[model samples]
Target: MSSLREKLKTLEELQQIDLDSNEVRAELETLPAKRAEIDQRVAEARRAYDEEKSRVEGNERERRQLESLLAMERDKVKKWEGRLGEIRTPREYAALSREIDIAKKTNDGQSEQIKALVASAGELQKTLEGKADALAEREEANEAELKGLEERQAAAQQRLAELDARRAEAVKRVDPGLLSKYENIKRRRAGVAVAQVIGMTCDGCHRHIPPQLAITLQRANSIETCPNCHRIIYAAEAVNPPAPPPA
Candidate 1:
């Protein structure tokens, strides 16, 4: 009974260490994917900013083109008006007037186009400014998040190293046969190789343990396994109990 109790104690300790190690390892595996998600968000923000900038630049270019065309039309109207006084015949005068009218109308159309382009450029500029601000905020947030994740990963890695040493020490304390059984059970049972019997209940499978089996576990007479889950079972009260009842 004493040997069985000692073995159970050692196995329990080994199980706890393995559980902790598994949790840390699982977290470590997810860290890279988490970092990648942050990188993707930052990249998307930068792309949006670039696209907004290009749109504003395009509007400005269109406005400039419209202004140049308007200037040329205005110049033509001015030259035709100046030639009006030099025309000697009525036909010549009429021709000059017609040319001036056409030039004026072209100039007016170009002016309207330039005004619309300027307004569009103004609106695009505002949108670009908003995008720039949002991008800056996103970048700052990503940097902070990434820094925090990196720190957490480093700490987890250090903890894993410590757990590895603890596990190695624990492995030395258990009997080789018992350790082999534990390893096999753990492989099949989601890393849980030991189960505690509490009031006829198997903690591992949450099944009601047979009364006879529970009694055997309570005595801690020999190594026992849960019939339902096939995991080593130990009595919870045998491990630790509350203070004795008063007289």
Candidate 2:
């Protein structure tokens, strides 16, 4: 049997081990979420780039089509002008002149269409430029954020490793049977294996421990368990009182 003080020390060490394990697990779990957020930002930027490129290409295609129509109209006008002097009679000449007027109108309409397409192409180009710049900025910011997250993850892992090493040392000081009991209870209850005996109350459940159990706990130097929560119990000098020192 160990002294009450030694047993309390062991329990405190177990609590520390539990705390460290929880911290390590929490840090590990957060890494994936952080990486996912950065990846999402990168994906959004890539999508913006692709959309901009598509819009620019579409506008270029429309502009090319309008230019082709304008060229056709101009060629028709040129041919009409060439035939203006070939008429045999005044009525035919007048008819040719009317045809020239209609051709001019058609050419003017085509010119207007070409102008509108060019303006649209210019607008699309501007949009693509703006989107491209935005994508680049987002990419840079995301990269920096990812780097910082990775550094934090590395630091967390290092601290966890150090804590595990210390926990191994702390475990060596406790009895094997006591350590086994602590591990079993910890696995069942979330990360918490030990409870403080605080004035006849089980801190694990905040319920009053029976008077008999309280008496046993007050005197125990070996492993004890809480009847209410099944967590290991120990009398804490800070959270529980100890017998008066001898004079």
Best candidate per TM-score, number?
A: 1
Give per-model CA RMSD. 2.7, 3.5
Per-residue lDDT for 133-246 in model 2, tens only?
988898899889989988988888888888888888888887787788878888898878888888888888898888887777767655678888999887675434567899
Candidate 1 to native Cα RMSD, angstroms: 2.7
Point out the worst 10-residue segment of candidate 1 by lDDT.
235-244
lDDT scores of the candidates, listed in order: 0.88, 0.80
lDDT (tens digit, per residue) of candidate 1 on 27-74: 999999999999999899899999999998888888888788788778
Residue 66 local lDDT, model 1: 77
TM accuracy, model 2 = 0.82
Colliding pairs, model 2: none
**Candidate 1 local lDDT, residue 12:** 86
Question: Candidate 2, which segments miss by more than 4 Å at Cα?
Answer: 1-4, 87-106, 238-247
The clash numbers for all candidates, in the given order, read: 0, 0
Lowest summed lDDT window (length 10), candidate 2:
234-243
lDDT of 2 at 190: 84
